[model samples]
Target: MADFRTVPFLPTAFHDDATLDLDGQAALAATVAAAGVDGVNVLGLTTGEVTSLRVEEIGDVVAATRRGAAGLPVGVGLGPPGAGTLALARAAAAAGADLLVAPVPAGSDPLAPLGEVAELGLPLWLHHHPAVTGARRSGDELAALATEIGAAVVVVEEAPPGDLLAVLAGGASAGVGGLAALFLPEEVEAGAVGTVAGCAVPERLVEVVARYRAEDAGAAWDAYLELLPWLRLEVGSPGLRVRKEAWRQRGVLSSGRVREGAPLAAASKLAITRRLRQVGADVSAPYPGS
Candidate 1:
């Protein structure tokens, strides 16, 4: 059972050629760990780009993440029980993942497909995203389902990610992505354990969580507020290049290229520069065309 506090929803790092950058992947995990994350998750939100990965590639990514995790727990997102779900789960576990994020089908029994994944012997993170799945479970329902399936945590995707309703329902809860940052205070007040956001620099978020949990909510708000500009730069269709670019500029990644090939907007590029400068981040100068 992994109890996370500031888990980062990591992106798959890639080289300029769009191949998996194992070193970059490791560095991303290391960077997040340095920020003091309780755990780190990749591939849960990765379904958007899931079609781009082969089974072996997924395994490789998990192994690379494990290498850089500094002994912290790691989690991977798994989809509905496809013929390959078990294989993917085994790969993730063999590669060092301690848990699986299982997305429940919408408007149906959330536990319908979980038995197979639980069989992998890794704890499960039940993901309930009504917006994506079209079946919204109330807080009580989420809490009940988690209890029924013995979920280590219930990941709710909703505004505030804290999801007051779910928290009030009485289960351990976590939220994901940029939206979690938007109303962290509300999320915290609502009793969210921590958030799962994927970003190049996670120290800022770690600080916010630490500050908030320590009861200096005003300081937490200040830390989270400073990240508003950077967090909002979800550029490109399905959006992630800006973050990859941030990693590149910081020397953590070689390039910001993603599988989708959507060019980073010119304005986003400028915004990344401004925000990085504001944080006094040391960006690597002079990429090939810049």
Candidate 2:
């Protein structure tokens, strides 16, 4: 099973015309791999825009991420909710995914779908994000599901500090999704295996994990604090447009254009760029289109 302790769900980059920019996506993956993340997750809420992508697109993204990861373990978030989940799982596996991530299927019996996904023979990373999936499972329920499906990891989204601590205390190798980097030290101290942020500045996030693992609590806290403003901005935004823009400012992506949306205001872009620079992100280049 792939170690998901410090996985970063990558943001999918797009050209100004809204087509998937595969090269940009590859560069983003390669950047994270170079930064020393434990693994990479694609096609997730902030990264893949899973619900908006077609089945074939999902496969393409997975394949592209695999290529860019350069042998780092790659996990694919199963795209969208549908009867086609099994097919999607197969596509992801075929495209070289080392792990499959998905929410418990919505139904009278979520376990049945969970079983179906487990049958695909890849390690599972069960996602519990009530805000997105509209389903909440107790910690005991999650542990039981892990046991049943043999999940390698569990992603708890929007988890408060206490809830995250509780999950770790239960001995589940859990990761937090969304803007909770401040909790990284506490979570690591409480036994969190990793964190999953869709931040554009992956190197900083990676440093946060590395410092903590190196037992440099002060350094880790400082690194996480440096990322707090960006994380707060991300959590408050609706989608990954800001993140893509941030990457564009860093020259990791060709452009920040999200599919079917106006570009962020020039002032907002400038502000984000300045904030990123203040936090020591490598934003030496000018923002695209500035």
Top TM-score prediction, candidate number: 2
Highest lDDT: give the candidate number.
2
Instruction: List candidate 2 segments past 4 Å from native.
Output: 1-4, 168-182, 288-290
Q: Write the per-residue lDDT of candidate 1 for residues 190-251, one digit (tens) a residue.
A: 66666666766678777777777677878878887787666666433444677777887788
Tens digits of per-residue lDDT for model 2 on 182-206? 4566566655667776777777787
Error of 2 at 68 (Å): 1.3
Each prediction's RMSD over C-alphas, in Å, is 3.1, 2.8
